[model samples]
Target chain A: MAAGDSGEDKLIARLFGSVATHPGALGLKDDAALLAVPPGHELVLTKDALVAGVHFFPDDPPASIARKAMRVNLSDLAAKGADPLGVLLAFAIPPDMDAAALEAFAGGIGADATLYGAPLLGGDTVRTPGPFTVSITALGAVPTGQMVRRATARPGEAIVVSGTIGDSALGLALRLDPARSGFAGLDSASLDHLRDRYLHPRPRLALARPLRGRASAAMDVSDGLVGDLRKLLSASGVAGTIEASRVPFSAAARAAIAAEPALLETALTGGDDYEILAVMPDHEVSAFSTFATAAGIGVSVIGHTHEGEGLSVRDGDGAELTLARGSFSHF
Target chain B: MAAGDSGEDKLIARLFGSVATHPGALGLKDDAALLAVPPGHELVLTKDALVAGVHFFPDDPPASIARKAMRVNLSDLAAKGADPLGVLLAFAIPPDMDAAALEAFAGGIGADATLYGAPLLGGDTVRTPGPFTVSITALGAVPTGQMVRRATARPGEAIVVSGTIGDSALGLALRLDPARSGFAGLDSASLDHLRDRYLHPRPRLALARPLRGRASAAMDVSDGLVGDLRKLLSASGVAGTIEASRVPFSAAARAAIAAEPALLETALTGGDDYEILAVMPDHEVSAFSTFATAAGIGVSVIGHTHEGEGLSVRDGDGAELTLARGSFSHF
Candidate 1:
């Protein structure tokens, strides 16, 4: 990172200007970006921040860190059933940060912005006392009044989640304490799968259009399924019953859990799963599943909404199970 | 300042839920905010970040810190000729921060959001190891194709500024080293006036409408006027000649400079002056000035754009003045 104001300006123009292809971005020379929302389309706004040593290790790959910053917000947009348009990034780093590292980080951000079709609109970079951090504010658009929300679920609706869960949690476990994770029996490939999931999350953006047209309510599960489901139920003034056995888990996660039964709790309440959780009428389940499967993403029916209050999870034998904790939190 | 996931959720709901009253905000229960852009309107986006011990004193009132975070972005919207619609905040703070401080910060943010008519749409809060930081992305709306740009200045256009410019810079000097600020001769009220300017910046939002209709180019002077004007001229592919004598200063600022002549450079090149700098056709200057005056804001012609390459500042005698530096730099 550069030390002064002129250096900061020059750094922005040289490192970030190329991504400001949108005309309204004004080539990033203007103070604010101009975004023309198509008629009848409403904008979706979401922001997420990643702090070194908390969100990711300080030595983590710059590309992965950048991708994570963008993906978290992308996950929010996906849950809202909107397509991303652009993003503004704010970076705070120690003044002594390597210039090459900053370049790599920007390159990664630009790469993901291009991949997700969310062009870089503009950004602010500044010096921090310690612990580099990145904050991304992503903008998207959906048809007027069509955004899927968490408070619209109703009784008798089927709760579905896109893609498998628990991998990220297990991945973190392995990354933090490989030997103590009790995954020694797992094959190397399984360990790699868990680790990779922790590094990058695939937001269910492809399901946005389908969910927007049919789902009653939706949100991205970032803070563990049980806790997030409870939040969703509370917001909708409803309750839910989730089948523990039906909660999708990747083969790697299944093996790791099989090696240690206590891992189930971690799978249940250890967040960082960037997958879409949606509620829809039971009648639309089959069609939605088919469409989702055809698109190469799994859509599993794991629960149902009810008129009561909180959330409960049932075991394979249909007996309600208790959890040690509800969700992953950073306070 | 909660300690875990559930705690974080509770904190957000308890402190911020009421402010997310916009229907599109979905009561702060959704993954992203939905904004229905009125027909024929475009969104203006800008993001600014403030770091503890960098942007402001870490001991500054939490409310002032929060207000500064939002006001800096509001200043950007003002320069863009847009009316703020909403704001999204991202906060990364030390986990051990006092709960009372967080409450005060939130209250301050809420107050400013209300005062600026930019409601809080959504925000993300997370834990940082050290150095608390706040990043605000403010969204605004302007009639389609009406956003003012910094690259639109043409030769022969008159350069204008809304409000006095040097108070903030001088105020910062006094705050940093009170005894050396050369303010001992000033009355207590004048000292307070300078200090207050440093703490709170009044963004020129009211000038947006008139500037949109008439200004050839516009930008907010966050950096010093000399550097910012150079940037504007560079972006517009034009040059300018500024009359230093015409640069406006507050009475307190003039008094301080009279006591220490060298403080003039600090007033000219030191940044943090959140005033609006604009260019307009000579013919529109009178009308624009009349409208600005009626709005109770001062508008002064300090320069003129020309078909050249760089900026030059001249005194009342037509002799060029030398500057130690063009602008305040953070590098």
Candidate 2:
């Protein structure tokens, strides 16, 4: 019943009200907010920016834009096994961004932060003349020494992946041309599922804890398999091969891409996968799969590391299938 | 040079560098960077934005703009006894903004941050179609129970202000219309000093620790004396009055304003003072002043908080002089 209970002020209260912290916060009445770190958790900090047309579809719905903004940052934290603590968002909007759009974007941000048990810490807002931009600086806390690194892969380690790899890329292609998905029996529900997954990625923070001791040199597949895996391998000073027959693909994706041989390479090299990719020692592979199954997440053995420094994938006839090593670059 | 020396490669290095102890941060080679917090210090976070026309003059030099951006945020942190730790800059530029201007702006930011001992953390850059905008989110730390709050002022507390007041607004007015300057004696050096101070404020962060136990309540003066002090009184549920004879003014300010009576009132109430206003118990006033002087900062006793709920300033013989509280109002 206060006069300030509408618009940005209201949105701010709703976004940050759930943050439970030490008594030192003073309930957010000042220019800045305060937070205390408990003894057990180490803080994790990361920042990312999503520019209009640069990071996402410029015409994407506001909610989707908001979701992408938070999700990508969350994905980074997930790869580290850091649970979401809170986020600081600095948003610059063009005057063309209407009031309804702004409100919806804020709503989406609040929803995701609450869903992940993360609170909104603080942020800045400004108006620009050009396109919309959202920058989120995330903070999380994890127990010390449990984080996975991308530079620890060993030779002979089995390359493992979480969920499916090709779905997001396939979904993106379909979304770009919604009319004929080219899959004979594709249903609306399946299309929607893929679209949702592609639009909003689920960070594998859950697997971060379980993968700590077993998986060496882990990272999320943002860029497609072949591309991101190359970086992972280069970091670890190792490389490996995958079987073309084993590149996981949904039925719809397979049907759509079967006639276009280049599609396989595209799907393998495209970015935005947001799935976990790691190297597990052969002896620990079984236990790792079991642990993943217990957690109700998918795990697959896709390839293995070799002494050489590049990737190689063979078809069923044992002939090598050439591939590209770079995906979407940030610049 | 090392492999990371190239501009393009430098970005890759920056993204992958510095993974702290937090479990989710395995280094930045993946899609996001990770970090961990150190122990002991409580976090103080503040955010402020500057628009091209609204917050500043359009012709301000790029270095001054950057300096003002950090200064405004620092002023907020100083009010709470917070030591500035780092800053995140989110910039939105108009397409027409020159490349040289932008480079100068960035250089200024680098210089100020380095001088303050707070390095850049991370942020975003984007193109905008509207007014040029700069948003800064700052991080500072203070020990538990050491920060000040505006709402904690007692009824009998003495009110004090740091540094000279009314100079910036008067200085700005003179700069805006050189021909209209009331003082015929105004010279280049004096005008330059006043102009620089108006453009680039100095936040009193060093005084945070010194004033920790001294002041009961405090805040920065962004909106001139009466305006900002009105805010303090509203927060603390008290009323105050300043003696007109006791109001602080510089010799130059007096000379300039004497030509126009209305101009004097504007200076007294104009906003963006960037000074600290604090309330202390009457007994601690002398000690506070002494402490400030020892630190090489100026101080003045302006007013006192009484049990009432309004603000006023009285001339000699208790005659009230009605004036607008300093600064412009958005609405």
Residue B94 of model 2: what lDDT?
69
Q: Write down the DockQ of candidate 2.
A: 0.43
The candidate scoring highest on DockQ is 1
Model 1 lDDT tens row, A1-331: 1113556557756777776677767777788888888888989999888899888888888888999899989999999899998999899977667768877888888888888888888868888987989999999999988999888898889999989889989988988889964598889998988988888888778888888879999999898888888878887999899999999999988988888888898888887899999999999988888878888999999999988888989999999899988988532
Name the fnat for model 1: 0.85
Candidate 2 per-residue lDDT over residues A1-331, each given as its tens digit: 0002237545544544444232333444555667775666665555666677656777888888988888777776777667777777667667687767877787777788777766666666655555677877676666766566677789998988887777777677667766653543567776776677777887776776777677777877876788778777887889888876777776656766674556677577766778888898988888877777887778888889989798887887879877654564432
Which residue pairs show backbone clashes in model 1? A3-B330, A3-B331, A4-B330, A4-B331, A5-B330, A329-B5, A331-B2
After TM-score superposition, what is the CA distance of residue B93 in candidate 1 from its true location, in Å?
2.0
The 10-residue segment with the lowest total lDDT in model 2 chain A: A1-10
- Across residues B69-136, which tens digit of lDDT does each residue of candidate 2 receive? 98888888898888887776666666677766766677777777777755555555555555577777
Q: Judging by lDDT against the true structure, name the best candidate.
A: 1
Name the docking class for model 1: high
